[model samples]
Target chain A: MSEHGTTLNIEKFGSASEAKALSAEADDWTLIIRPQTGWFDLHLADLWRYRDLVTMFVRRDFVSFYKQTVLGPLWFVLQPLLTTLTFTIIFGNLAKISTDGLPKILFYMSGITAWNYFGECLTKTSDTFNANASIFGKVYFPRLSVPISIVISNLIKFAIQFGLFLVFYFYFLFRGSNIQPNSMLLMLPVLLLLMAGLGLGSGIIVSSLTTRYRDLRFLVQFGTQLLMYSTPVIFPLSSIPEQYRWIMIANPMTPLIETFRYAFLGTGTVSWGMLGYSAVATLVIMTVGILLFNRVEKTFMDTV
Target chain B: MSETVIQVRDLSKRYRLGVIGGRRLVDDINSSMARLLGRQDPLAKVDLLPGADKQKAARSDEMWALQNVSFDVEKGAVIGIIGRNGAGKSTLLKILSRVTAPTTGEVRVKGRIASLLEVGTGFHPELTGRENVFLNGAIYGMTKAEIRDRFDEIVEFSGFEKYIDTPVKRYSSGMWVRLAFAVAAHLDPEILIVDEVLAVGDAAFQERCLGKMEKVAGDGRTVLLVSHNMSTIQQICKECIMLKNGSIHKVGAPGSVVSEYLSETRVATNVDLTQWQDRTGNGFAKLSRMAFLNADGEEAGIFPIGTTICFDLETTYNRELIDPLFEVIIHDPAGEPLMHLRSEHDGLRIGKVNGRTSVRARVDNVGLYPGRYFVSARIAAGGRNVDFPRLCGSFQVTPSPGRHGDLRLNPKWGKYHLDSTWTRGDQ
Candidate 1:
């Protein structure tokens, strides 16, 4: 009796709250479902209610990220550092791309750190429908949580790479390098938000499309690579000829990379107009992405 | 009276048939453009209409899995949905659980519903038992605090406390199922929808989970269950809805509905039943074949009166079994059971049996009156029946000469025949 009292006690178990959710007059209401009348039906409040689910997804992704690898989390730091070295050798030494007078290695590392987050967000979110078809087929969850967790999980990797950049920055600074971080460093968060929004927006759109047309998956892979060259990953935005500046600036990510560099290295272009333009473009793409994602998530299991 | 918790109105789901579900790029672009232009999807007339990819699509390459189905359930109601494969029973559960959307109509649910379609729907193999409990709890929409409070009870119920911290990948399938069922049953669902997920566990575990579900229903919470096990529905569900060919065939008390389902499958008895779906057992042993026999102990369909009535039950064991009991039951043409026989009850010992053994249970001089009767055979071990073929096979009984000289027997007389002597006596 005591054992049943301890475990099976309804009130103590706190499931009564979920029950209370039913007794409320609101829960008993009718929900009319039909072909969506409009483009957007984002269930924001439901997503908020399932924040714990999103947290678990993020934890699962991050924890399982390096489960069996011998080097484990050390690979987090090693990956970006090695990439920066390769970029320093190839783009900086061979091609001799201008970094706007910033140290070539530091410049490449910062760019890689910022661009890596965006690339991870894009690839991971693009695979959401295909990779999670097993779970989505059996369970009811805010499908948005899957992509949201991808963005957040990739942020942890971004943070590790960013920390490595900081370590190098301090090393060069204490060793009497001429570079100094500018006040634009405060714009770092806005720059990251733009990248995340763009990646998430484009990722969901491609993922939703790939549910029916799988070719988008391969396109996303090569597309993200080609997209990096168009952005100022190795070269500063100022290095682009003035005539070609419009083409570079048109790629919304170009302004993000330039702003991020200007904040850390204090040498690239950062403007209220360009940042505002990129922000508006990102918001619009995100709105479209969400609509497509919402439309496809309900029935993607059949096609995916 | 409890209020109606679920009201499904004209619910329908349509699904395309075969491997063409992944639409070609050309067709998808055309459909998307049509939607953008505010036109009915041209493909939807022939394929899934976007959200209507669940079941029963009826067009060129499509078929409607469910068509205009409607039902209502009151709070505290334990309702069962029974159907053959592709009868849309699962599609209905998916709609009610909100796992899939109905193509047309609306279902208003007045409670926080949780559906256990599969016991380990989202269980991660890499996660420890404790971690999976919380993960699975959250998947059921249980809050963290609720899971934390119920954590110990769940572990106790599963009887895996010592291995709670061990990764579930290392656990046996049975052990994994127990933990998953334990978590699913304890999640405090106001309206629980279960779909044959509880069928995987051992009989005792299945019984305990069924008891917990009954307790939940007894608390005036609604439950919708789908199972092929007729006895399970009869045990917990008061009402049963039988679906046939994607529509509601009947809805009434569990007895009539279950009997109807049983009779429908009676025609399939002519074929081998090794692939039959509706059976419950630990699966250590299986009944391969069942046949009625005559005095010679050879397989026969007709038995004469005053002749030995017996049956041959072939047993196959994947692993060795101990003291397994093989039994047969005879039912008259009226569907009333005439006799129940168990090898163990008859004091027949089948100790330490392995693969491919046949056993017989017979009564010298058939006591049953001549008529047609049915037989069902099963093997049981560890207090649980394993291979129970609902209708094993049927045979005919006819009259022959006895000591009393050609005494005919039929259903008009009582089922049993007793030898008697008439002598000169004073009244």
Candidate 2:
């Protein structure tokens, strides 16, 4: 029997815990029945034990998107590929946007891959309250599972795009194109991390806000498009004039996108210090996002 | 001794009833601006305090959906939470299930909780029924293998095998509810919370659901049920809790709690609409009040099934009323209409009753089940008529020991035959 049960043993305790404890005490699950006062004092251990639920949510998100469509999961790859081609033709040729000496197709494809992950994460997370209000009002699961699952689900789209990016990289190399490798390639994971963190953080924050103001819901779609322009998705970071460079650097996503391009093509500028600042900023945003989300999860149904 | 699985203390939830319009936006912005200045806003002051029911007097301000509610459930206890509309029964379940937080107080629960608050709420409309079963079960925290083990059970329970591969949107509403309920009931959880979702299905399905709930209760799992159906509550719940105006009115054995609820709500000879002042509808003829008189011509709140009664109804029309036909319907607690009487069938009509008029209906043998019933009246002129409006009356038909089989009188011609002259000629 567990210590808590033994302390209040008016009746004989079940041997379920004792039997498991005999083999390995570490392996035995602990059930805590705490009287929590507010949202700040959540039972984290219980949430941890139910991590499988988070996984299931992610699976549901991924599978349901492609279940009935004729093209199915292939749309995951095609969506980004088509967007990259459109940007290449319009921004690269017609508008003549600077790609910083890299091939137009590769530059736009890389940006689309990173940007799509963030955009999907933000849009999905922002709409969480409105989309799942019906279910959230009925069941009791760790609400964090929802945003976490969104991030994971969007990763599938990113992975498919990444595969296309790899194909383009190999094709450029086989065509005898001049692309050199640098130590900055090691920073790709960090860039991906920053993108994921920023999207999830910003998404959850806006999602919570939209539950109340509802005006935020209207802004979410338009705001995401405007936000893309502020980031160096189609243009090189170096093209920004000196006076506006500081503003671009402070955008956080600027350093992230710059580092990703520099690592892949060895053409754009890479600043380790700027990348470090962006990473720290992403972490801070995610923490605040989580806090706001926790508070909102408790009362969202009332407002929703 | 049975284990105690859930303990609740002083749980209450307050909901703000904001006005529906652009004015609400101004209040919201003003509150945020006031907070920026480190000052309290005028609109924030409208928040209802915990345990306050006075806030409901105004329709625009916040309402305390739940107030000072407290109860505990023993392990394996099947508790029915009963109340009138807006009594906070659903809010209480939401709090217990952790879907929403209480404004004040705490709940200590032991074991994994599963709430069927809305059957198949997690289901995707475009997904196949089979796919939804797995998806919903997984969302409820069951493992894929666990769902696989229960898949056949779920399919059988829903009885939707023919359409299992079809998308849920294509299924009929009843089939959707059945599939949703099937997934919820099959997932074994230590504590099960169910709302009034079972009312969506047909009679046989409802009976089957009741049987399933009984079986779940018998398995030593804790169950919290919120429902308006008193008969279902009495059948399945050993204990009951009564909520009134967002507060705990009573909690104990099912019989006592239900009876207390009935007695507390018992009206005299006349029905009062003053308490239910708030009304919802386009302006038409409205039922303001009603009454039922006993043999002594005194107001009788309750009566036996066989008792003769005089039902008096008062209604006010918003527009012209001419050649109005009135109808009264009596429904059981399950919302199944037991008896219907229309004034037109009996050649009873009022010509051009334009204003408020008290119409009296003399009824004989008002056969009813031994439960609470709602009486609604409708008035119509020609083809167009007022929606069933002014008949907000509830009455109880006390159970009689002598009436064994059914509540209604079953007439027979065995002993009371007067014309017996040719009875021997047939032989």
Candidate 3:
């Protein structure tokens, strides 16, 4: 431990107001910075000092968006509900995409619900610097708190949407829509965690890059759109042709979507090998993302 | 006794001027592919040396924002950081506030810190002022309960009672600044750092903020303030640090540091305005130059408070134009306008001229704060035109022998300076 040196002897005199009045009366104004060797450096105490500020920023991100809307918190549920309806109409009915003979709404809703969480997190994380540069420039809090808050706030939205899926799932079961809860459903939390980790990880990585080239900004939207095709979002994993099955299975999201559908409908394929692969991929990507994010947050202002 | 809460050791931050570094998707893919084959990084085979600069045009040139800087801040000490533009004062404060990290060296500190590098900085424009206050407070590290406790005070301090529910985007710039400052000052933190935010808001608000900062510091908290206003800095800060370029030029007693800063960056009395090449507007009704003539009618460098003065402006009108409006705006050294003089309402035309024209304005008395000031003159061929070349020059106003604070006008028993007298009569 370092020994403390150069303690300032603060003479407890009067109230701050009294001191201010006395200073004004004395008519002596001064600006002082102690000449030393370590002014422009990182200070953890500063970040700890501003922890409350980080929390406030997190709350702001969470609450401000839905404050004025008519549906209010219900908007969260409505988002995935509407998206699930669209996917059911497009993939289940028109395209005749197979859901392994499960209820159309239930199959598509489960996939969309999980997929939406990842998409939202990734998109939000990718735009972190560009979206909040003005705020970041003006105040000093933990820079990571911004992206971290984005993930947390989006989690709340995901929870609400997920709850809506649950409600609809029970409705379909009650209506005899060929759905039954399975043992795989118990792993829902783990699958959701994987989705969040991968989305947040990739989002922050791209966000760090988008601050510089901005070319990635366009690619993020395009790539997300293309990446959706590779995942088992619309069609079941079994629908892929035999030769291309390995390529589809190689996607990190494949196990999440498959396990999610298998949990509720008990029809889609679920494999421990695929889940383990995704877990490894999630860990690797998250490590890379955090390292890159930590490095970028230090000097992104220069490039951004 | 106040303990040294923050210790920085040989900290320096260097930034690339125009470049990019780090891995791209291709790099990541290639690295992963190489690792699959048990090989070294593919790009490492090319630019393996530390000084290698020929690899890419993206990651070459750089500049140092903070170089070899060091300091220790004792708890409860209100230190002011000051410098001219681009002196790295903000950068130093930002680093201390932990918004960014230094490229070299380390910092050790104790306790919580909240920095308002800018007012209303973290505000979401779409959110109401009420929502923003909570959000901004949270960002500053306040708990929801803490924000709730201080919520009323923040709102009342801003004096935006009726507009609290309004989205911050709709609030005036003044309201925005006041609200932002209120949130920052009210956050109960062990260390508070602010950067030149006092320049916002009216005089009374600035005074109130200074008082609040004093109160915070008095409560055994550390404060780091960066501002250009010497008087404000001197009033609020006990010690001062003067930065030049990217390093500390001087530090210690605020009075001495401020004086040194002023002397080093001060514009010479005999400054030639003609050499400034950045003046806007073309030669068409262009203002070539401007100067301040003293009470003795001699061209002078400095003005005293409440001195009668004349502004001599030379303009080159290239087109045959009708009535042209000529105006002169006087701004304090910090770029705050003190007064603006214009040909009242109608345009003052030096009609149909293709040659140079000189104009003059005689004022009874010019009252201004004791500091350097800038004179920006404009000559528009017609009313409501600002694109024409305007004359802009800066001048200094030395503090009067007996005067104080920002405003120069002396008043007699009035709330504001309005050139009036008050008498106590039977109410």
Candidate 4:
């Protein structure tokens, strides 16, 4: 709202009079920082106002990943690649988990690529409170910009890893390796959303809890690793006995990974009711996560 | 009508003591279990405030860092918040900046605010100076285009142009602070809040920063400056708020408020270092007392110009010291370093003070311009700082009324007036 400074005369900022006009109309939107709010309160408009900060945070995360390394962005590609190869051997060849006649590489790579997106998001957003306490202690920005940026930056990593999976998919297709296409493949975007929403929700919850008890941090890392087993990343859901299959289906992540596998590999189960349940559960967790996150962001500085 | 850029009402902050604020799982479980069994929680309460009432304070662990403190700021006012350590200056800034919420009360602001509570924060060591400028700018809420528009100016101001593309990790810590402050100085927010962390910058850079702050203040942006340097605050700020024990003690022109701050609550001056209770160094040695001596070997609070001004540091050693070194730093009233006298610098190793011992340092022909000056004392055994009081005590170098010639000292012109023979002949 300061239009008189020479700073506004800078070319990219447009005219000082424009800021005057804007401030004149925005008279009633004064931001009042209060001590308390309802658990669900969020300054979404303020977050929108700090969009530049979100972009900057994302850019920082993107560029600072591979400093001093010979292979920078290549790590994005190699992480899922190495994990997929390891899964193909440890579970596919050794334990003999069925991929329902789908190519082992294709089946396992998709799962890792899909789940890794959520795991990366979870890990980064979980550290949002602890890692940024110094900066948070100094300046005031919409704190949510931090966790949101983690999700956006992890989205970029997911896209690159997803592209690597695509290359292998086409290579197997040329080799006629029985990787089939089905109408369910169109469900990929929805499945991706469920993954992101679930990841962000659980992440902020853990992050919020860790501000009080740091013991949750160790649990978060171990929990994310253990969660993959419950979600069927290595083995398809059909490989399990029907009586025990319900245990995997009970996990909020199972239906998402299962559906992703079903859509691409055309060999796994997909239930409309289970998908609905996953979406509903994700919504509930997300609401709870955001409420707890907002509560913690208010005074975490003192405790942190 | 002119706007009130920031307004606050009944602001307060409470913090718990005896814990790191990280409550362990066991503690949480024990508390919950007590609640379930209808028993009282062991960590029920404690008074954490610096000055709290006796009976209630005895029962609670919570500290009220700020208590019912409130003030309003008119648009474009350059106000200084001055306080000693633990006076809640930083906490008040944190609340105003919305970095943390108050335990009670509310703050309303009418414009975008940019605050820097710490210097060189958010600077990635691996990022280049160019990238960090943009990165830190954006972190402060400036858009990329804004940083791009001002990139040349930033690079030039930081004087890192020759190495702009090089990674910041290679830059010295001072260069990093310069770059960070350069980016923060250019913020175009409607309200600017700055903390004393700028003290980290060298004197020249700090001068430039104050000049820039003055220009920004003139540009009609409200500025709230916090610092322990009374002179710097008085130089730039028209009005000041002096905080005492977490409340506003006075709000008036900088001159009166600063004098009030100086006279009544000078932290530790002339106190024998041994009895200086706010020490954080190991218990091996204590600065017992600081003695200001005149030419007659008697204690003196005032000295004439061109005289040897001597101060004796009496330190009581709890443990035997090795190669014990003493250091004294004198600063002008403006908080600028005028001299650093170190026993080690003089190639003298005064060893092993088993008990009460004294070291004396003298500035011969104390050609200092006649004005106010203060000294900070330090003792380092081996290489670690032992007893370093920021302000040991203040003294006046009163001008001799009939003093003339090259010795006609002008305190306003410079801090020191060294002895030199003037030869004004044609040669």
TM, every model? 0.74, 0.85, 0.79, 0.88
- CAPRI-style quality class for the chain A–B interface of candidate 4: acceptable
Question: Which digits, one per residue and each the tens of the lDDT, describe model 2 over residues A1-304?
Answer: 1111112111112233442353353322223222224556655665675677677777677767787688988998888889989999999999998988888999998888888988989998998888887788778777777888898888877888899899998899789676766788887777787888999999999988777767778788899998889989999888889798887788888888877777778887668788888989999999888888878787777775
Best by DockQ: 4
Q: Chain A of model 2, TM-score against the native?
A: 0.85
- Residue-wise lDDT of candidate 1 within B80-153, one digit each (tens)? 99987788898888777666677776778776888888776778877789888888887777778888999999
lDDT for position B146 in model 4: 90
* Stronger candidate by lDDT (1 vs 2): 1
Which model is ahead, 2 or 4, in terms of lDDT?
Answer: 4
List the candidates ranked by TM-score, beginning with the highest: 4, 2, 3, 1
Docking class of 1: incorrect
User: Model 3: residues >4 Å from true position, as ranges?
Assistant: A1-59, A68-82, B1-3, B6-9, B20-61, B105-107, B125-131, B148-177, B264-288, B295-297, B306-308, B316-322, B343-348, B355-357, B384-392, B399-427
State the weakest 10-residue window (summed lDDT) of model 4 chain B: B50-59
User: What lDDT tens digits, residue by residue, belong to model 3 across residues B1-427?
Assistant: 3455655566666666534443356666787899999999675433223553232212345555666667767778888889877778877877776666677766656677677777666678878899898887777667778889989988888888899999888988888888888888787878788777666777777777888988998998989888877777777899888777667777788999888877764444333445555456544656666667788888766676667678887766567666666788876555666777887543454556667677778765555555556666777665545323322466656655533445543321212233345688998
| DockQ, all models | 0.17, 0.23, 0.21, 0.32
What digit string (tens of lDDT, one per residue) describes model 4 on residues A246-303? 8998888999988887777777888999999999999998899899999989888888
- Local distance difference test, per candidate? 0.78, 0.75, 0.72, 0.80
Which tens-of-lDDT digit does each residue in B58-140 have in candidate 2? 43366667765555566788999998777888888878777788887667677778888777878777778988887788778
What is the per-residue lDDT of model 1 for residues A200-292, given as tens digits with 9 covering 90 to 100? 999999998888777678888899999999999988889989999999999899889988877877888878889999999999999999999
Best by the lDDT measure = 4
